[model samples]
Target: MSSGMAGANTEQPAGTRRNRTSEAGPAARRASRATDTNTEERVAVWDAVAAYVQEHLLVQKGVWIPTFGSFDTISKDIRTADGTVTLRWPVFQLARNLRAMHHLGSDKDSLPAHREVETLKYSEVAAAASVTWQRGKTCIQSTVSLLSNCLKNGENVAFVLKDIGVLLFEGMSFGIKYYYDFLEKLSGKEKFRKVVFKAPWLLDTLVSRVAPVASLTHSGHLVVFPM
Candidate 1:
C-alpha cells in the first residue's frame, strides 16, 4: 500500500497538484464566492438603471432632474358635452391666461408682474434655475427641425417629443410652441403645454402663468415672418 501511494503521488502532474491544493484552501473558496456575488450585484444595478431610464426618460417629453432638484409634468384635459379633446399643455393654458389677464388687469396688474420679470432676468436667477443649457439648446434645434418638416409636408398639425424639446404646432396660422416639462404621466395622456421661451416678453408672460423660471440663452433670435 505504501509503494502504491508513492507511485500515485509521483504520477500526479505539478499543475494539477497545484490546482488541487489551491482549491482546497480557504482564501481560494472565499475569492470564488466573492467573484460570483460581485457579478450578480453588477447585473442587478445595470438592469435597474436601464428600467429607470426607459420608463421615465425615453418618452416624447423627457425631464432631467438636476442634483437636489425635483421635476414635474402636467397634462390638461378638455371635456366638452360632445366628446373629449386633449390639448398640448402649457401652451394653450399660458397663452389663454396671458390674453385674458392682459384684457382684465391692464396697467394696474402689469406693474407688479414686471417687477418679478426683472428679477427673473438677473444673473442669479438663471444660474439658480434648474436647466441644463446644452440640453436645452439641443431641444430647440430638434424642435425647429420637427416643426419645419411638418410645415413643409403640408401637415395641419404635428407633435413630437424629443429628449431636448417638445414641438407642437397648429398649422399655418399658428407658431409652434416649445418647452420642457418636469412632469410625465402614462401614455395617451396629453400634457399641459407649459413651454419656456427665449423671448423676454414671452418669458414674462410664462412667469405670470406660474411656469417656473428656467435657464434661457441671451442671444437674440430672428423669426422670419411668412409671406
Candidate 2:
C-alpha cells in the first residue's frame, strides 16, 4: 500500500497529461485561427476595393472611394512626324476637402541666404543651373521607371508624401486610393462625394515638381515609392 502511494505521488497519470495537452491545444488553435481569420478579412476588403474599381473603370471613366479620393483617366494624343500616337493613363486628385491638408509652399526661397546668388558670374550661374537640371532629369527618369515596372508587373505600390498623405495602388487594372490624417480629423464634419470625373501619368509630373525623393524599396513584387 505504501509503495503504491509513493508511485502515484512521483508520476502523473497518463489521462492527466493528455487532458492538460488537450486543454491547451484548443486554446492555442483558437488564437491561431483568429489571427488567420483577421488576415483573410483584410485581404477580402482589399480585393473588394480592387473589384469595385475595375468594374467602375470598365463602365465609366473613374471612381470615388470614400475616406480616400477620386481616381480617373486621361487620354493624350501625340502628333509625331511619322504618325499620331494616343496614350491613356490614370490620375488621382486629393478630395477637395483634403486639398487644404497639404500646404505646398514656394521653393524659390529655399536656397540658403549665404549662397551668393547675385554675385555669381553668368557662366558660373549657367553651369550650376545645367547641373541642377541634369540631376532633376535623372531623378524623374528613375521615378518613372519604378512606376512603369510596377504597372508592367501588376504589383501593388504605395507612396507616402511628407506633407501630403498616403497613396496606394492596387495594380490589378490600376486602382488607387489615398489616405490622410485630416480625413480622420474631419470625419464627422464632411462626407465623400459620389461624382466621378475622368482625371493621368500626371502623377509623374507632380512628383517631379513636388517633394524630393527620400527612399524606395521593393519586396517580392510590391514597390514602396520614395517618401
Candidate 3:
C-alpha cells in the first residue's frame, strides 16, 4: 500500500504555483529597480567624465580633479631605431590622493610613480587645469571614494576612459598596474593641440619597465600639481 501511494501523482495545483509567483513578485521588482538605479548612476558618472575629457583635455595638456589626482600628459622624444619619435602619454594619477594611498599596502604612493624602471618614473604629471566640480547627487568624489574602498578589498578595477584602459587592483601585486595601452598619431592641427595618450604595452609591462631606447626630455614641467 505504501509503494502504491508513493507511485501516485503528488503534483502541486497550478494555483499554488501562481500564489508563490505572486508572493515573490514585489521583491523581484524591488531587486530589479535597485539594479537599474545603480546602473543609471554609473552611466551618468561616466558620461560626465567623458564630456570633461573630450572638452578640456583634448585641447589642453591634462585635467586635474582637485581631490582625486591629475590626468596629465607627458610628451617625450624617444630616439627609436627608426628615428626620433614624439610620444604623448596621458598619465592618470591617483597616487597623490591620501585616501587611495592608504588603501594600497606600501608601494603605490603616487598615481603612476616613475619607479619600476628603478629610475623609470614612466612619465611625469604635467600640471593642467583642474575641473570645477558641480555639486550633484551622484558625484565623482563619492564614486572615487567607493573605488578606494574596493581596492582595499584586494580585487577591483577602475577605468578612466575606454581609450585609456583600466586601473588594476588585485592581490599578489604591490602597487598599481595599468593595462591596454596604444599609440596613435594626430597631425595637421596646431590649433587645439591634441593631447597624445597611451597606456603601457602588454609586452612592455611583462618584459621591462622602460623601452630599449634613450628618451630625451625636451620640456620638463618638473614641479606639476602645485595645488
Give the per-residue lDDT of model 2 (tens digit) for 1-227: 00111221222221111112222223232333333223223223333343444444334346554333454444444344545444333345433332333321221112222322111122332233343333333332333344444444444444443222335444232223222222222221122111011112222222221222121112222234431
Q: Evaluated with TM-score, which candidate comes out highest?
A: 3
TM-score of 2: 0.31
Most accurate candidate by lDDT: 3
Question: Local distance difference test, per candidate?
Answer: 0.26, 0.32, 0.33
After aligning candidate 2 to the native by TM-score, how far in Å is the CA of 180 from where it should be? 28
Say what the RMSD of model 2 is.
25.9
Winner on TM-score (1 vs 3): 3
Local accuracy of candidate 3 as per-residue lDDT tens digits, 31-138: 333332243344445445544543444444456664555655555454534455454544555545634465444432233444221111111211111222232222
How good is model 1 by TM-score? 0.20
lDDT: which is higher, 2 or 3? Answer: 3
Residue 195: error of model 3 in Å?
Answer: 17
lDDT of 3 at 12: 26
Q: What is the TM-score of each candidate against the true structure?
A: 0.20, 0.31, 0.46
> 199 in model 2: Cα distance from truth in Å?
21
